[model samples]
Target: MIEIVEKGVTNLELSKHLIKRLNYTQWKRINRFEFAQIF
Candidate 1:
């Protein structure tokens, strides 16, 4: 798996970069983590 944080632009562009690196499984894991944090 790739690191969640990357050295890049500090805006939507960076989000795009990070998203591109994540596979479906990684996305699900991250989504679950964020969901848990909200509860």
Candidate 2:
């Protein structure tokens, strides 16, 4: 119960870290394109 919740939180943090590390460039590009489309 508590342990499961802790594990889930840990996994979420890990995945967030990984996405930031792996997709930072791609994310920036997408944001730029999105901003360009809007403006």
Candidate 3:
């Protein structure tokens, strides 16, 4: 999804912003999921 967004986004600034936001969101979500399973 992030890769698709990056490719589809024409504006450089918007692409950069989305990339950072999506990456961080995915990271946080994955961490939370893993932490939950650890219990």
Q: Give the range of the ten consecutive residues with the poorest summed lDDT in model 3.
A: 30-39
Evaluated against the true structure, the overall lDDT of model 1 is 0.54
What lDDT does model 2 reach? 0.53
Give residue 30's lDDT in candidate 2 (0 to 100).
53
Clashing pairs in 1: none
Error at 15, model 1, angstroms: 0.6
Candidate 2: regions farther than 4 A off: 1-9, 24-39
Best candidate, TM-score-wise? 1
Residue-wise C-alpha lDDT for candidate 2, range 1-39, written one tens digit per residue: 356446666644544554667767775565545544542
Q: Taking the tens digit of each residue's C-alpha lDDT, what string does model 1 give over 1-39?
A: 134334544545544555688786776676655644543
How much is the lDDT of residue 35 in candidate 3? Answer: 45
| Candidate 1 vs candidate 2, TM-score winner | 1
In Å, residue 35's CA in model 1 sits off its true spot by: 11
In model 3, where do residues sit more than 4 Å from their true spots? 1-10, 24-39
Q: Give the 10-residue window scoring lowest on summed lDDT in candidate 1.
A: 1-10
C-alpha RMSD of candidate 3:
10.1
Error (Å) of candidate 3 at residue 28 is 17
Question: Cα deviation in Å at residue 11, candidate 3?
Answer: 0.6
lDDT of 3: 0.54
